[model samples]
Target: MAGTQSYVDDLSGTLDERLIISSTPQRSNALSNKFSGVLSASYADSEIRDALHSLDENEIKNTAETRRRLRLNVQKQVIQRNGAVVQEYGHVAEQLKRIGAIINSLTACCEVMRQHVTAARHENAPVLEEASSLLVQKQELETKKQLLDAFNKHFIMSEEDLLVLTGATEAVDDTFFGVLMRVKQIYVDCQVLLGTENQRLGLELMDQSSRNLNIGYQKLYRWIQKEFKTLNLESPQISSIIRRALRALAERPTLFQSCLDLFAETREHILTDAFYSALTGSSSGDNQNPVTKAIEFYAHEPLRYVGDMLAWTHSAAVSEREALESLFISDGDEISKGFKAGRQAEPWSAGDDEAFDGRKALGELVNRNLAGVARALRQRIEQVLQNHEDAVLLYKIANLVIFYRVTFIKLLGPDSSMLETLSSLVQSALRQFQTVVSDNASAIQAEIAAPTPDLRIPAFLDEALAQFTTLLKTYDSSLTAASSSVADFKSIISQALNPFLATCEKMAKETNEPSAGIFMTNCLIAAKTTLSAYDFVQDRVSELNEQLASLTSSLVEYQHAFFLHTSGLHPLLAALAPTEDTPGSLLNISTLPPFQLQPLTDAGQTLDDFLPSALMDAMENLKRLGNTKLSQEITADAAERFCEDFEFVEGKLTAADELREIALREGGEENEKEEQELVPLRSLFPRTSGEIRVLLS
Candidate 1:
């Protein structure tokens, strides 16, 4: 078996060499190319080795047979796969044929469809064009429908709205206001339409809206007028409905102004009637409740009567303004907007911007309301002023008128006719007061008598001051703010006190010296006491103090002279008087005849006697001074003057004594003889300045 296997191996080796190396080049190339994708030499060797290892021993021994059987199995599998591939290819061919048939049928159908489409296009050309036109029309119609719907929604007023706007009997409620507002908006929108390029519809709408707006404003104007005719200003509040109507009416400047005029006229009549009712006790409305008694009841008292009339007017003015405040001022912004809208609608109304100020409107209304009553008030007050003869009373009335002037200025503004009337009344009263005062002063001056023996102020001057006191008190008690500066009160002082005091002074000038001083002092003291209590009169008080000082100086001089005369020193002082033309030798008082030792001794005796009672006698001299304190001061001041005179005398006496001693020591016989004739200074005057001060003190 080994020999047989060896021979078979050799044979296999010989067959491999012949097949691989000895082949023709073309065959070898073909064989290599065929196997190149089939299996690599290394891979084939590895597979053969694995197969050999996997085989049992029996299979190894049967390797040749195994190889033959494996070859056959692989060939059979290849044949089966080939048959399967052939069958699959046949099925694929059948499917391709079926797809071709389907494609052919689709192509035929496409050809038919194309033919039909071409035929239709040729037959219906106008229809297609018409259909396209219809589509465009539909879109255009849709757009117009939308625009018309919006126009109807915004621009067209419903029947109900028109009725509310134009209904004559309709109340001026919020619905009326809303309808009016819509109509105005439509009118304004019409203006925008008028501005557009296509303005036919805009013109139609504008005409309709303008007519509706005019009717609406007419209705508002009429309604406001009717309401005003019935408005009771005694009530503090106004209705909101009226305010709404006024605000709406403000859109038509002419109509709004007309309404205000009618309202103001109605209020004027009402206030005038009420004034009469207050004055005549003719019962009106609840407004009469405040004035329980008629103004006529106070007619006996001029101040109270005129005061009541003015108070009533003021109260009525305030009430009327408050009631109408909401109708104008409270709706200022709304009214302004209304006016602005009107201006936009009517260009000519642009200047009506100033008309929207509620404050000014209210003031005008108040002034108009008080117009009729104001004239009557002024006439009556002036009548009362003219009838009264008392200057102080007339001044009080003037102050009353001034107080009302200020009050009305605050309530109705400074420009109101009521304030004008009050101002005129104030001037009238002041003029009459001055006239009455001048007449009274002239009468008193004409009836002037000698001052009383006691040097007291005369009865007429006292009466004048008492009236002045009342005047000052009236001014102080007034409602106006009192000015602290003295200049502010100078007019009143000049008018009330100064003229009367001047008359007193003129009369005093006709009297004797001391009596004139005393009486004038009394008058000044009375005036000062009256004015000193009021702060506004402090300047007058200071002036009176200065005048008093002047008079006191005069009294001091008088008292000093009295002292000199009482002490018998007047002649000595007269002798000692230095004449401007006196020669030098006689210039010395010792050389003068009155200063001789005998004359000095006699004057010294008189002064010594008078010193004990000098101050008392001086007090007696000025006893009529109304101010006792001033009298004592003048007496003391005079005593000081008396002491100064004694000091001067003592100085002269010492000088004369020194001259005499010098002559006795160093002079000739005649000089010594002259010195002996002159008395010693101690013997000449017994009184010293210190003793005089002690006595006076």
Candidate 2:
């Protein structure tokens, strides 16, 4: 077996050599065939084995040497590659060092350049700024020069043009009077042009024009003073001429009238366009009434016309005062003559009549102007109140009235008849406000009365009270102005609430229901609470509180009495304790034995009939009254007392039953004795024989 195995191993080795040689292209085909032939040679088994052993030892030795040589070669190649890498890294390090030096040099140069640039900027900044400033100044000077030239070309006028424009002969005339006349004419022309321009231009532009004209007016005024001094004019003549000049220049009657007309038209437009349209929520094309328009105008813009009107009225008043003082001083005889002639019903002289007529004309002017305004304002107020029921609007109207009152007083002087007219209007409005308050109070009272005896608080009560509080606050100023008005308001409220209190009191007295009194108490408490919510009721708060307390106390008493009456104790107690003049009394028991038993039996019987029903009703009533512990205790006590009395009366009847039973058992022998024994019992019980028999059975 060893020999066969050896041979198989030799064959396998030969085949393996052939496969390896076949895979190698570099091996010669002759060498591969020679190895195959050697393997396949016919040789003894031992010889082949020996050859195989030698070949194995040689192959192992060659494989070990080849592996050692390959390891040496790999180590040499690794060392060479590591040396090359180290050399390349040194070169890269050297290049980086040089590049870093270059970067540092560039940084230093940039720093020096930045420092120089900063120095240059600092050195040039002021010169650049100065040059810019000079250029701006030069531009400004050029602009001003252009504006001056334009102004000169446009506004500077020659003497002839000035004369033509101002209706003056010459601005610098030879004579002082002529110069004064020229200046006056110039002032007059400026005033006329200003008025014309004011009407055509807007308010801002007109303001500018007025400023320019004011300078001219000042010059004219100064020139007049100079001319008056030069001419050596008297004070009276200077005053007269100056007054004429000022009147002619400043008080342009036609222009003033035109301004008034414009004011009226503007007021009308505002009323129609803005105020009435917003107030009534309707377009006021043409159908709106003059009264409504006037009201809305005042309501919306109460101060719109006040300033202008006051100015005009003040000017007119000053003029009137001057004229009147002059007339009184200069024409006193003429006025006296006119008055005398009028008293005699004869025509006055021309001077007297003319003076009287002038006074009349001025008076008419003031009166008619103020009357129209006052009448229109009063009608507007009426229309406002009629159209709207706002208490706040009433206050607004009152405020407007006060403003007008003060304004008109100032305008017409407090003693003018116009003040009386305004006072009447204010009074009328106050009366209307009072009426509204009274009406509202009446309405609230009616609401309070409408609920049944149950007095369920009306749902509208809260809303009504809220409205009342608002109304009071709105008119608090007016109401507090006079104690009388406050009193009147209090009276109205009392009148309104009185009926409610009276009704409650009447119901409380008439009804046996405790709920009636409770309802009344609640109503009074509610009324008090509602009234207390209002601050304007401060004056009446104490009085109202007292009234509420009294009413509540009375209602409480009624409630307690009704509670007692429901239990039937009130009537029973009244009967038991009769007064001196009353005959029937339970205390009279000893004087009449017969009547004593009758009273007890009658009282017991009445209680039996009513106690149960009263107890049930009382239970229900107390339950309705909130089921308080006191009510429960009262009911229990009443029931216990009634039951005890019933049981006592039953026991007395039972004793009488036993007595009759004994008498019947003894027959005629014990009858007389039993009768004598029963005498007192009979008086106490008052029972008949049949009743006794029935009771005994």
RMSD of each: 8.2, 29.2
Instruction: Enumerate clash totals for all models, in the order shown.
Output: 0, 0
Which residue pairs clash within candidate 2?
Answer: none
TM-score of each: 0.82, 0.35
Q: For residues 529-552, what per-residue lDDT tens digits would candidate 2 score against the true structure?
A: 666755556666677567655644
Highest TM-score model number: 1
Winner by lDDT: 1
State the displacement of the C-alpha of residue 127, model 1, in Å, after optimal TM-score superposition.
Answer: 4.1
lDDT of 1 at 630: 75
Q: After best superposition, candidate 2 residue 421: deviation in angstroms?
A: 5.1
What tens-digit string does per-residue lDDT give for candidate 1 at 1-697? Answer: 4433453466467567866775676666766665554334453477655544444322334355655686676577679989999999999999999999999999999999999999999999999999999999999999999999999989999988888888776677889888888877887788788888999999999899999988888887888888889887667688778887777776777788788788778877777877888787774554554646677976778888988888888888878778778877778989988887777667787765564677987898889978989988988888898788888888888888888888888888878988889889988988898888788777777876677778887777788888888987888877757554456457768877787788778878778877788788888988898888888878779999999889888877887888888888788667655533233323355667766678778888888888877777777867887888978887888788877976776665566566557656677776776766756755776677898889898
Weakest ten-residue segment in model 1 by summed lDDT: 578-587
Where does candidate 2 have its weakest 10-residue lDDT segment?
581-590
